[model samples]
Target: MSNVGQHLLSGGLSGFASTICLQPLDLLKTRLQQGDGSSGPRFASPTFTCVTIASTSARNLTVFRTARDIVAIQGPRGLWRGTNATLVRNVPGIALYMTALTHARSVMAVSPYFKAVQKYPSGDSRTRQGSVLPTLTMQGNLLSGATTRVAVGFILNPFSVLKARFESSIYAYESLSGGFMSIVRAGPSELFRGFLASSLRDAPYAGLFVVFYEGLKIETYWTSHTTSAGIHSFSAASAGALATIFTHPFDVIKTKVQVRSEARYHGLYKTIRTIMTQRGIAGFFDGVSLRLSRKVFSSAIGWAVYEGMLMLMASA
Candidate 1:
């Protein structure tokens, strides 16, 4: 198969694995971000701490309680409520993300700046005498990550909208088809309702993720401290954690904009203003910890598996 095809397969497999493992966390994060401020007793009483429905809750649910609530309400499978939509979104979303990243790097490599750098060969054998390519610059990594994330994110937004609704308390669709039909009934505009917020969140998050991950790898390689697999996973997790923290407010806004059953937010600016007025400074940071944990775990698993598959395929 072609290189792009391999990237697609590897990315799809890795993303699938990551999504399955982290779906519960993802659900919790979404629920927390969607929380409004009202709290009530859970019917099943998932845990010792307070737990409530997404729309009803003002405060974020604790991660432990969130997991328990899912089990209590819908059984263990409840945690994976949006699995189908998530898989559909992530599998191809990640494939396209990875492919775009790679192609972006290649495309960047041929730029005038890189071409100028290439004019002067490195002294290192791995980059010169041996069969190893040079690393991307920080700028290149950031640009590629942002560009790909925005492109694929926009394309796959409908799935994102569907997934959010599926996991949310807003809609109780029996099946994926039901959810799709409901969204269709809502109108085509609903699918792209949060496109601006999503792009704003995704573009910065993706850019920072690549920059930090690649930067970490560069440092690790320079230190010669571990194997490629170890470094890759570590870097991915580290990057994810940092990026999630920095861009968490955008995530909150994106979720709010995407999943509102009613038209609460007229636009991105108005949404931000409303959140600030209602929830204050803390509103934008709802579920930040949960988001960070989920992002770290998912990114680590996805990047590790993807690189491992590439290594295996190269060996084969």
Candidate 2:
């Protein structure tokens, strides 16, 4: 396969693996973010009420309990309720994001302003052991990560809306195509419901993730004089955790905007006001643990597999 093709394959495989492994966490996060209808317009559907009842009790909304409730209500497969939508969104979404990010970094690396200072030999640009991609300056990492992520995010946001609704109890979408058509019928506004909030979350999250991941790898090498896939995984996971925490509020708002039909959630400022007024400061952190867990493992597994595949392909 060509380099771009390899990047796509590698990213798709990584996304598939991570999504499958971490799907339950994603479902829980959606349910958690969906919250109770108490703060907004309540759906009249019994299914919505039932699902909300399972996780709405302040004391009973723990992740384990919510997960158990899902299994009780919809059987074991309930946890993977949105697997198809997630796969549709994440597989190509991750592939495009990775490819765009790689291309951006590669292009930037050739520019003197973004080029990494070479402290080692020239043939292989692997400044540190197990680092396969071209290293750029911190500014390069931030810019490339932010711009590429937002662009890919914008392209795949319709699928993102589908995925969010699929995971939430608010929508009873019969099929992926059906859900997609529903959004289409709702018009372009619904298709890009949370684009602004999503962009806000993704831009900084991607930028900081790259900056922290690269910085951690370099720092680890400097401190321990070693680097490997293990170190890369650690760095990526740590970076993901930090970035997830920082950007989680926007995530909550984005989920609300996409999944709920209430007028309160129809706009960014209104959603913020509703969350703060109803759920307080802690509201923004809803489902944070589940998101953190999923992001950490996903980042670790995804980046490790992506870089490893690229390295193998290059060596071959």
**What is each predicted model's overall lDDT from 0 to 1?**
0.76, 0.85
User: Over the stretch 155-243, how does candidate 1's per-residue lDDT look in tens digits?
Assistant: 99988988887776655667888777766676777767788988888999999998898777666656655656777788889999988
Superpose all Cα atoms of candidate 1 onto the true structure and report the RMSD in Å to 1 decimal.
Answer: 5.3
Top candidate when judged by TM-score against the true structure = 2
Which 10 consecutive positions of candidate 1 have the poorest summed lDDT? 42-51
TM-score of each: 0.87, 0.92
* Lowest lDDT block of 10, candidate 2: 44-53
Error of 2 at 219 (Å): 2.7
lDDT of each residue in 190-285, candidate 2, tens digit only: 889999999999999999999999888777655554446676788899999999999999999999888877678888999999888878888888
For model 2 the local lDDT of residue 192 reads 90
TM-score for model 2? 0.92
- Model 1 segments more than 4 A misplaced: 38-56, 114-134
Alpha-carbon RMSD, each predicted model? 5.3, 2.9
Candidate 2 collision pairs: none
- Candidate 2 wrongly placed segments (more than 4 Å): 36-41, 44-60, 119-128, 222-227
